[model samples]
Target: LPFWNKGSHSPSNHVIVAFEAYRQLSQVSIRPMTAISSMANIHEDICATAKRKEAAVIILPFHKHQSLDGSLNNTRNDFRWVNKRVLMLSWNFC
Candidate 1:
């Protein structure tokens, strides 16, 4: 499950397994987010927190998309809002 987190933009096994798990589980909310912030450092913090928490629903590819900054930054921010107690329990990907 932890293998999905490769530290950067590359799909890990954990992400695939997590996606399948989500399909089977059907109750958990899997939300994906980008990895960017206005200050860049804040984005790094968000990413760090997510890594610490073993986040699920990771942003894939990390490619140059149109809304990459906005989406990922928001998701990271949202993940930060609830990272204290919540456990993602899923794999990650790039």
Candidate 2:
């Protein structure tokens, strides 16, 4: 396994960490759970799935890279736009 540097601002590494954490948590939690495996067109897919299943809450993870100085370095513009749109559309249900 590749090790990430402490306070690394790598988006891919962050995603890997997030998924692993979620996996571990799911194993110990007794509540029912579902994992969406696809990443293609994620924004659209998540919205469609939520609407179809009438999901109570949709958790969207935003990607951000922080520098050693504790300032945000690179932020994902695509995710930012998608999150905004999804929040707007889901307002009625939320």
Best by lDDT: 2
Cα lDDT tens digits, model 1, 1-94, are 4334556654455565676577667976555444455542444555566677677533533323257455532335444533431323222313
Q: lDDT of each prediction vs. the true structure?
A: 0.48, 0.63
lDDT of 2 by residue, 10-68 (tens): 76566656655665768743222345644445666667778787666566667577889
Model 1, TM vs. native = 0.26
* lDDT, candidate 2, at 42: 60
lDDT for residue 31 in candidate 2, whole number 0-100: 24
Q: What TM-score would every model get versus the actual structure?
A: 0.26, 0.47
Supply candidate 1's per-residue lDDT for 52.
73
Q: Identify the runs in model 1 with alpha carbons over 4 angstroms from their true place.
A: 1-25, 29-38, 59-94
Segments of candidate 2 deviating more than 4 angstroms: 1-45
